[model samples]
Target: MTAAVPTVSDAEAAVILARCDELARHSSLTDGIERTYLSAEHAAVNYRVAGWMTAAGLTTWQDAAGNQCARLSGSTRGLPALMLGSHLDTVRAAGRYDGILGVLVAIAVAGRIAASGRPLPFALEIAAFGDEEGTRFGTTLLGSRAVAGTWLESWWDLRDAGGVSLREAFLAFGLDPAKVGDAARAPQELLGYLEAHIEQGPVLEEEGRALGVVTGIAGARRFLLTVTGSAGHSGTPWPRRRDALAGAAEGITTIERIARAEGLTATVGHLRVFPDAVNVIPGKVEFSLDLRAPDDADRDRGWTLIESALTDICGTRGLDLASTQVHEAAAVACSPRLRAAIATGIRSTEPTTAPADAARPDEGGSDSGPEAPADDAPRELPSIAGHDAMAIAAITDVGMLFVRCAGGISHHPDESVTAADVALAVDALEAAVRALAADYPAL
Candidate 1:
């Protein structure tokens, strides 16, 4: 027998997209002289979102640590609940959709469910996590980490670029820094979590697909490299001179070559040279390197190649070199059950559209493309960037749905998405949520 198909109405999808666009203009997660953690502007956006949640028929409240939550109780008492959420913070000069879309979409979905007058089997909680951007405090996912009980005490003392401590910022926002532990929830209390967000990349648009069933979050390592060599007069003969800038340039080129050859993604995003004079031979250079892969072993192998190349280049060029690790996070695989549920929902809701491509064919299943058998689903891709879902994954079963982004441009003022794509994503999410609610009823 064929599985029952679940679907959402076009009207419902439109309502959700309208709400998302409305919220996007307000938080403008992309705007602020600087909304970095603890800034007055950041706090304002948080409070505004909380108010919007309350208006949407949720019992919204702000935690002692400033995290915001909006609760929607189901008919089943004492049943494990599902959390749907995403962050509200943005990177410096970020776009509106990066983190805000997921949270607002959750809110709209919950509102739709409530308006239907059908009592859900399990309760749903919508959260708008704070400070995931790490633009300030130099720490990411502060709100979600707290909820998962993974936040460290040392986090309170962490400072921003301006040397303002997290604790100071918390107090300034009228939140108690010492009460952070209150954010943790019993793992048993949360049955699962789901997030719907923009792809923030070119994949979906390139493939002409409306949805991306996330397979896993990629592993990443961030480090800084410094190349030092003697400064010399600009007119000095090339034969007898040591150029730190030249060595750093060679290192950059080597990194590009290695990453391209290995099929790994490597980036040298930031670079600084010493000395203020225009003609001065640079004595020192510092650059940040970020490398990511689908798994730890692959990520490590890429880094090893990078290190070997750097050492060889520095040694042969008579330049001193050093490296420091800034941050590292391992890849996370989504639950198999959740992945299947999302794909099933997508197929059921939009029969005319193709099924999701299996991200890792060997592990998930075969990707037969559009011509594949009806039983086969397209492959889902792994996301290299960090996401709010990562934090939730640490505590409970988590799944993600990606909406197509226009030109893969994110974290910029010009970031945008089409109205039709937004509607399609909402339909997929609604169907997915209803299916999960039925299959994984509160116990």
Candidate 2:
């Protein structure tokens, strides 16, 4: 359960943070971060990351799916690889560390391992996926799914907001659409996958801990719900009017109540009203529902309850309700073996102290600074947000370690993490690799 180094210094953590800021400079936006899939910005960052990987004694290449990949041989020159990575693409106006943090931390870990002059049971690989946020083309994990050999031919037809097809975008990025298959990795060519990511929720921050172990990624269902009712004049009698907006408001509230009662998450993040004007009653309403749970059965049961409630709300309001399911994904459990390895990593770790400017969560969520952590025991939690691991799960067993982020804020510019946590994260992941190596033959 020991690593080449017991603790990654705060100085190294500062370097990771500095690298993040440097990558942020390649964003498309003039004002904020916005690196989408296959954009010039993506290529620029990949080039920058490749330089870092090479300096760390790894062979670097860009896969057909446009993932930035690097490999370092173990004691055995041609053994299966243990891949460690997270996405590099992001939603528009994203924070500095959502996906970027994982990539940099992984580089630090790999760099340290190579510097140790010791080889593990398997080779090491890093993949900086180009598209996980799906901010540009409306498809999540395209990068990782391609690597998992799950790329759909129809994906070429998918277009972005500017009406550029994925196929065209690939060519624009100097990639051949026909060669994307080359990115796929065979199941036998790897041991397993591990991702170190921000909690992106307040659990760790609230509990005053620096790191946590992910139990599983939540199963999710997304839908577009429409309410139809007739528009009316502002002067229409209340008894005669059918207010779609009002009905939608009631429906959203009911969704919240049912989700709360069921211990699930149901969010109506987007809403649209037709015939919108101060002088007219709304004729129709369209809203989005995002439901998630750690268990597929529990998620389905919660959705059933939600459907019943929405039906009742619509019926009472004399409105017709219709729903179209847009997306669904089953729960992905982290491998028990890998989970144990991560736990071993956490238990053997210690925190590092850095200057305030090095890293600190100061905005809204709990900022636990470089203080002593709650306990050495692993804090286990489920990820509600989707990740690249969700797609990579198709090819291999996966595990994740969650680093506490500022107030659980992500996908925004204010996302924060302290250097103390980053240092601990690097230590834990490095130790996890060693732990896995020790048991590689049995695994």
Candidate 3:
């Protein structure tokens, strides 16, 4: 009868590294980080994360899609919460723990569950979001797609790169772009979402472990394409040149050989071209793409073999393709009872032993009982970038917990992590919120 070691102190790992160096001193690059979305360093990191969510006792606020919320209460008062969070916006020379160390490790695991007075049956919010690195409106999960009600009134005519617009940066950040649909909420006011973040890749330091268990989140698409043709005089003669950046460099190497024959994850990042004369020849071009998979029918079958190899590489170079699909999303998964409570919070962070094919049979359900998932098995993975839990997994049961960063190097400033792997990611997200309140209790 000994299972109970989820710790995390050291003054809660120096109050989550001094609140991630006090939100990287409200950035916008005084020579480093940037912090975007409704700017002014996103309102001084949401007024210092609502004063560290009211000194961690919680009950804060700031939502209407600018996110930064808080709360607490459980075992009573209007339950249904268990949210936790991430995203505090950043991206230009960013990385003081991408998305502020998952909202300061969910307010240091809700201040270690309100100093263990133990009552949790649900309520525990948190958030912090403010636009997951859309970096001032490129449109990534704008504050988790307005709390998953999926906001998109044409993304208020998205613009910024200085052209302004996301409704004049929400009325110059004072907010009220028609109350951003009051930041939608409703999946019965939630009782799922988790988060934690920072594995930014290298699979928990190549499985030497420090938490892991996302198995879902990659379902992107993006596109743009373009191509066109007929410009000339790069000594125009090669059959009257129809270049369009050489048919968009052979359609970006056949979109990297059909996303490397379906193991998926394409990219291209960006391009452009037009007639920028290096003696001309190119006519248009454009580019972009992106892709990504881990399902959604293999990211719509690799965008149908990258739109049939960019329509046979722009119809044998007479070039004229167009495209568009600016973004898609979809795949999310993670709830076989929260991937068995994030694989029982990465086996409560250590002490291992069972793996001769670790008791099979329970497929993805992982036999959700005593927080089941340890016979040395839990290392899920997936997430090929993009989060705000893919727009709060369209309103509920999300789950994630990564951790190990160092060489996965996320969005710049040498993206690191360690304070003993964020005190084992706040004791594996407080043992995945007490293994989902012992597998969903309190009716």
Which model scores highest in lDDT? 2
Badly placed stretches (over 4 Å) of model 3 are: 1-57, 63-65, 71-83, 87-125, 133-136, 139-167, 172-228, 231-238, 241-246, 258-264, 268-283, 291-374, 380-382, 388-428, 432-443
Each candidate's lDDT (Cα)?
Answer: 0.75, 0.89, 0.79
Model 2 lDDT tens row, 1-443: 54334334567888898998999998889999999999999999999999999998899999998999999998888899999999899888889898898999899999999999888878999999999998889878999999999999989999999999999999999999999999999999889999999999989878767788999999999999999999989899999989999999999998999899999988898899999889999999999999999999999999999898889988998999999997888899999999999998887764532223333633344223454453557789999988989998999999999998877898889888887788888989999999998987877
Candidate 1 has what TM-score? 0.88
TM-score per candidate, chains pooled: 0.88, 0.92, 0.36
lDDT of 1 by residue, 1-443 (tens): 67434344445445554654554555434443235555666677677778767776778887665677888778767767788888777787666677777887787778877777876788888878887777787667788888888888888788877788888888888878778888887789887888888888888877757677899888878899999988878887787667888899999999999989988889998999986357878889999998988888988999999999999998988889999998787788887777776786666534444323422211354222343244546448888788877877888998888877677888886566554455556667777778887785432
Positional deviation of residue 35's Cα in model 1 after best superposition, in angstroms: 3.2
Using alpha carbons, what is the TM-score of model 3? 0.36
lDDT of candidate 3 over 176-246, digit per residue (tens):
88888788899988978888888788766665566678877888878888889888778878877789888
TM-score, predicted candidate 2 vs. hidden true structure: 0.92
Candidate rank order under TM-score: 2, 1, 3
- Look at candidate 2 and give me any clashing residue pairs: 365-407
lDDT order, best first, reads 2, 3, 1
